[model samples]
Target: MSAAVRYDEVEAGQEIPAVDYNVRRLNLVMYAGASGDFNQIHWNERFAKMVGLPDVIAHGMFTMAQAGRFVTDWAGDPGAVVDFGVRFSSMVVVPDDDQGATVTVSGVVEEKLEDKKVVIGLTARSGDARVLSKARAVVQLT
Candidate 1:
């Protein structure tokens, strides 16, 4: 485990180390089962293509969850997140192959709040597309 990062030690514009989240077919299937989102686009490639998608696409909520994980892991406490939200700007095309699609997430402190909290701006990209936009998280620290 890494050392805990205190709110006093963080600086604005400091880049959080990026993490790549792999989305494989089985992973998507598991996510679908877990979230009860059986959207055909997330599992059936033919159905996805018929809907004008390139291939099976991952769910927007799945992508959002991955981004949330990025922030919580960085904060070292999932409960530290006070508020979190994201806008799904693009789809994450998932191909049925060993090299699954990778969603890269990174964040930076944008502003420090009054009571030992900070606003974190997040960016998530996958397959030459910006998947999440206007993603931000407010975290409380000690």
Candidate 2:
């Protein structure tokens, strides 16, 4: 954990440093094992293609978790996040390769609310496609 961000220090429209989260086939396998979500679409390219997906896609929840990590890491405390949500706009196709895919997460302070709370608008992208939409997080600052 790190020191909490003081509410007074953040201004609306301020941009947070973006992060690139890399996902590989092995990571998906580990996530599936831990999350108990053994869906073939996440690990089997053939099954994913059969289902009309371009290739094995990363779990939506896993992608969302990465976005959450982006915000929490910026806030310097997991507990700082009071609310968070996202709409899955597109699938994050993870090709079977050493590099797999990278989901870049970025955010900006949308607004400051009462009680030292701020609304952070988030964007998650893979290639040119927006993976997550209308993503937002309500974080409590010191």
Candidate 3:
């Protein structure tokens, strides 16, 4: 889908509506299968604890994908994203429960670059700790 946001319509510092993505144990299993990253830490609680993790942690790629989804959804086009990157700042602990965990993502238009491209600053948090940092996305608008 093409972005509804035109290059001239957006301004620096504009905020995109925040999104909360849910990550559950089942989702992790699905991701592991799809991505072929069958690391024990992501699915095995015993191995996770042995590795000094608090619990089964969500894969960094999973968290990054959620953040990327936030940006692409805002742009209204998955292909409109020209660049996207994030640093894993903290672990998202997922417990064996019905609710699992929630990752909240928010973004601000940091700058408007040349050629209808804009830089966006992103923040992703799970509980009280920031799970992703230095997250940024460059998107092209019509």
lDDT of 2 by residue, 20-94 (tens): 999998989999999999999999989999999899999999999999999988999998999999999998889
Candidate 2, residue 138: Cα displacement in angstroms equals 0.2
Q: After best superposition, candidate 2 residue 103: deviation in angstroms?
A: 0.2
How many backbone clashes are present in model 3? 0
Candidate 3 global CA lDDT score: 0.94
* TM-score versus the correct structure, for each prediction: 0.96, 0.96, 0.95
The RMSD of every model to the true structure, in order and in angstroms, is 1.0, 1.0, 1.3
Q: Which candidate would rank higher by TM-score, 2 or 3?
A: 2
Model 1: pairs clashing at backbone N, Cα or C within 3 Å: none
Compare candidates 2 and 3 on lDDT and give the better one. Answer: 2
Q: Which stretches of candidate 2 lie over 4 Å from their true place?
A: none
Worst 10 residues of 1 by lDDT: 1-10
Off by over 4 Å in 3: 1-3
What is the full ranking by lDDT, best candidate first? 2, 3, 1
Instruction: Tell me how many clashing residue pairs each candidate has.
Output: 0, 0, 0
Task: Give all candidates' CA lDDT scores.
Answer: 0.92, 0.95, 0.94
